[model samples]
Target: MRIFLYSLFLLFSIVSHADGERVNIASFSQNDINSWQTKIFSGETHYAFSTMDGRTALHANSTASASGLFRKVSIELSQTPILHWSWKVDNVLTGADERTRAGDDYPARVYVVFSGGAAFWRTRAISYVWSSKQAVNSHWRNPFTANSQMVAVQSGSERVGQWVDERRDVLADYRRIFGKEPGKLDAVAIMTDTDNTGASASAWYGDIWFGAK
Candidate 1:
């Protein structure tokens, strides 16, 4: 059996922004990493800093492990709902279905978590992932929890080893999937994992932020 690591979710100070202002969720610099905390599940994924395309990025290396660095925040989606970031993976995990527990792994993924409020059961999340076999733009419930949805933003090996930028409207996506207005966006997380498949993967994540049009 594979070993696992479990810990409490690390919470950070909430960030407030004015209208039309860009809010950086994670700078990923040495100073920023000090505030960002990691949660481990099924071994540990090594994370460090590396320069890519003339900018600093958080490099993740996973060998049959699952872990992620996350920061909590309070953002009003109506004002700045656009999430922007960039990531690159060495290659896709062959034969991983992503919709099955045994195949729930990804070369790269980012998560936006919403609070459940008093009910707690109302919590929800959107995981934007680079799928290995699933078609791009396809979305489904996470194998572990229906409250969390997986959306395949990037797929296949077409852009392996190359930096790819991404943008998504969290406000629109939340409404589309959950059929209701979203509460304050509670946190943002980045992960590169292969624990379920017992494989290895590597990925790099650039600056992540939320902004207006």
Candidate 2:
């Protein structure tokens, strides 16, 4: 078996307020990457800040590499279940099949990780991705790990280089996909990678937050 070492760095905490109305995950408006830590998987994906239409956003450039920025967070689905964010991809990866491990590369994705405590085997995650070929609104088990599922929120070159906003009811999606209730969300992460296809990709990420319906 191939040993994969996953490194996790805690940059900051994103906690819901007592009223539990909303939780801010990343402060992109402040052009800050300080509260986000980098984790290298294959090589490295350059992450920084750039201005788009006068608004600051996180930019990522990858050349056959895999890495990401993540933040430890605690969000209650019972209170705030909706997740909101925006992203833009310069181009879609060619000849990439999201169902196969060798084709497991994306231009942009945001995911949530859940911990299973002592039963670490039960840990699972849901990733929202911009797919290269998969149809929009489609989902499948990650080719590398069954515990992590991927959902194609955006697909093709239809929206390339265009900023698109997205909102999802994470609690509902999790229940539908996992067929069970989920524990507190352990973390939230963003990634743009092209290691599998050996292609280059660039993307931009806007402010991310969670809120009540």
Candidate 3:
């Protein structure tokens, strides 16, 4: 909810392996490993792609102002890293969003949590679309809020708006989508709505670099 260090607004990131295969956005510096610990979950002013303000029945589009909207960030990669980032989502056609609904809407996620936190996707590692308005290479059938999940990877298409590049190999993408082998990944989160769905989504992020191979 609130954890601040500002660490002078952290600025010093690494993109090693001699920066070979195109994935170096200003040599990484998304507030230095997401500022050790940050999680908003609910709202209090934070936007990069919809933070929150409530509407219902749909007719909204206002979320892009969180200085660097971060749902959660805190990394500790010691050896076993290979995660990349770059997203751009826009438009899913009026009324309800996050994938579709007129009365009970919900859906929107992108996660990776491993601090032995017990559970939140059965060991945490989700890339979601449980239900709602979908488009742009859309394909549905992933309803997992944690049902003894062993892995849930979604990315065969639907880069949402545009600009796409999400190459994850953080220990085989968490052992092929949460199967096991998450000794230490610490933290990395970017979520829009996951408190039990209230779709009104929006997104835009770019270049998140990792090392240790």
Candidate 4:
């Protein structure tokens, strides 16, 4: 599980840029995802371009598997701290406790990674997740590492099978969770994993971007 966490923060050579006021991350609506790369741990979670709600989206399906799609990018939070995206889940995993390693599975999650540079251990991340049981707005340290904080941005089956828009001020979230200033954003990732719970889950992700608040 620790390895899975570490891989999510691995720095890559590719770097992306922002426009005047927005940094476009995943352009799934354009059917363009060439900037993203896959990282797998345990079994593979299938990801493909698909249509959802009359628009192009990225679909992820996991069956007792762990995998993610990430893009290495550099963004100054002082300029564009707001992260925006949309997602929908088929259903929440049954009998899953997000606070434990054995049940550390999420139907959908978006990660924002901060590079640690030379001292790799200092690298940190914030996982904005669609929780199965955790309350919306509740947060806790990841089961495998404190460096990664899990925030339940969405919860339960009340809104299953429906597209939900999400927005987060990454800079404020990092400050709240770590009690310190954060470096430039290094990467962004999305995953729908069920390896720990040994269950099945499915989700669709719309376009992702960062903009000024």
Per-prediction tally of clashes: 0, 0, 9, 0
**Candidate 4 residue pairs in clash (backbone atoms < 3 Å):** none
- Writing each residue's lDDT as its tens digit, candidate 4 over 77-139 gives 999999999999998987867799999999999998887876778888899999987888888
Q: How many backbone clashes can be found in candidate 4?
A: 0
Identify the superior model by lDDT, candidate 3 or candidate 4: 4
Q: RMSDs, each prediction?
A: 3.2, 2.8, 16.5, 1.3
- The count of backbone overlaps in candidate 3 is 9
The CA root-mean-square deviation of candidate 2, after full C-alpha superposition on the true structure, stands at 2.8
How many backbone clashes are present in model 1? Answer: 0
Cα shift from native, residue 13, model 2 (Å): 9.2
Best-fitting candidate, scored by TM-score = 4
Per-model CA lDDT versus the true structure: 0.81, 0.82, 0.37, 0.88
In model 1, pairs of residues that clash are none
What is the per-residue lDDT of model 1 for residues 104-203, given as tens digits with 9 covering 90 to 100?
9998999888866655556678999999978887889888877888899999999999999899999999999889999889888888999999999999
lDDT of 2 by residue, 1-213 (tens): 001112321232444333467688888878876666777888999998889777789999999999988877778887889989999999998875778878889999998887766566676788999998898877898887788888999999999989999999999999999999998887788999888889999999998889997
TM-score of each: 0.91, 0.92, 0.24, 0.96
Best by lDDT: 4
